[model samples]
Target: MQKQDFYQSLVKQAQALISGERNVIANMANLSALLFTSLEDINWAGFYLVDSPDELVLGPFQGNPACIRIPVGKGVCGTAAHAKETQLVEDVHAFDGHIACDAASNSEIVIPVFKNGEVFAVLDIDSPSLARFDEADRDGLQALVRCFELTLS
Candidate 1:
């Protein structure tokens, strides 16, 4: 399927999943799996939730073993949390101070999840292809993150 169609289907599935249950972790896990399976060339898709101490604790994810903790200013995920905005890196290696959780990951996108105007978590996706994501992906994934945040509450 085309990427746009795949993303739309994912949004529909997420909405259905959230409507049927109010379990945040379960929902995130499902979403992670969906993104992992649907997106091509993706090495990772997951969430990092903000802990009370202002650190990111690894949440639901689908892929190899991942970093369990991340400070707010480090890595793409952490940078998104610290900036409270989306960080789309087309080339992970070129990003200064990039964290290499998986050397195969060439690109990444991180979207901050907000609750009551504060960042509470981030949705992170990494790809094995350089420039794997673009503006369309940014818009679609940002919309998907909104669904995720709403389902959590």
Candidate 2:
């Protein structure tokens, strides 16, 4: 399927998976699994939740083990959280301070999830191919983040 079409379906699937689920952990777990299994060439897909003002604790994921703790502004995940904006890196090596949770990951996209206008968590996806993400992915993943926000009270 085309990238756009795939993400459209992904958003629907994500919404359906989280429907009627109020538990945050459960939702993040399911969402991570959904993205990991559905997306192509991805080495990791998961979440890092804001555990403190300057740190993000690893949450649910569907991939190899990852860094358990990341300081704010440290890596792609932390940068997104600290900036409260999406960080789409076409080349992980080119990104200064890029965290190498998985050496195989060449590209990455991290979208910060907001709760009441504050960064709550981040949806992180990593691919093994260079320049794996584009504007389409950004828009699609951002939409998925919106779906996640709906689950919040």
Candidate 3:
């Protein structure tokens, strides 16, 4: 299957998994597991929730242990949260201020999850291959984020 179609299916699955569940942690846990098992070559897939005005705390994920806290505007996840935008890095090593939670991660994508126009958390995925993510992955992940965001209220 094409990447686009795969992502579409993944997004649908994510929506269905979280449907009717109002608990944020439950939803995040399910989504994290969904992304980890569905996407190939990915080393980490999970969330970093906004914990304070200047930091994000690890939420739910599937992978090795991750940094517990990331300051906003510091790393890839922080940059996405601080800018309220998605950060898709073809090469994690090339990104300035990239945090090395896992040295095996060569590429990454971080999408900010918003709630009522505010940054609620970020959906973060890491890959072991360079240039692992492209525009298709970005579009698919963003769509998934939008689907998840709908449950925030």
Candidate 4:
């Protein structure tokens, strides 16, 4: 499928999966699994929830075991949460302050998930291929994040 079409379908599927669910953890778990299973070339897909002003605690995930904690502004996931903007890194190795949760992840995309107009968590996806994420991925994933935001609202 074309990238846009694929993302739209994924978003639709995610919406269906969590449509009536109001629990945040349940939504996160399902969304992570949805992304991990639907996306190609990804090694990790999960959440890093805001634990404090400067730290994130790992949440539901699908992949090799990952870092349990990440400080805000420390890595792509943290950076996105801190900045409240998406972090799409084509080369994770070159990003300053990168936290290598998995050595196999060469690229990463982190999207801030907001609640009450503040960052509540982040959706993190890691790929083993350089430049694995593009603008389409960013836009698509941002839409997916919106689905979560709406559900968690």
Superposed by TM-score, candidate 3 places the C-alpha of residue 4 at a distance from the truth, in angstroms, of 1.3
TM-score of 2: 0.97
Off by over 4 Å in 3: none
Single out the weakest 10-residue window by summed lDDT for candidate 3: 3-12
**Lowest-lDDT window of 10 residues in candidate 4?**
144-153
lDDT, candidate 2, 1-153, per-residue tens: 788898899999998999999999999999999999988889899999999999999999999999999999999999999999999999999999999999999999999999999999999999999999999999999999999999986
Residue 70 of model 2, lDDT score:
98
Ordering by TM-score: 3, 4, 2, 1
Model 3 TM-score on a 0 to 1 scale: 0.99
**RMSD in Å for all candidates:** 1.4, 0.8, 0.5, 0.6
Model 1: residues >4 Å from true position, as ranges?
none
**Candidate 1 per-residue lDDT over residues 121-153, each given as its tens digit:** 899999999999998899889888898778656
Deviation of model 1 at 94, angstroms: 1.0
lDDT of each: 0.89, 0.95, 0.97, 0.95
- In candidate 3, list every pair of residues with a backbone clash: none
**Tens digit per residue, CA lDDT, model 4, 1-153:** 899999999999999999999999999999999999999999999999999998999999999999999999898898898888999999999999999989999999999999999999999999999999999999999999998899867
TM, every model: 0.94, 0.97, 0.99, 0.98
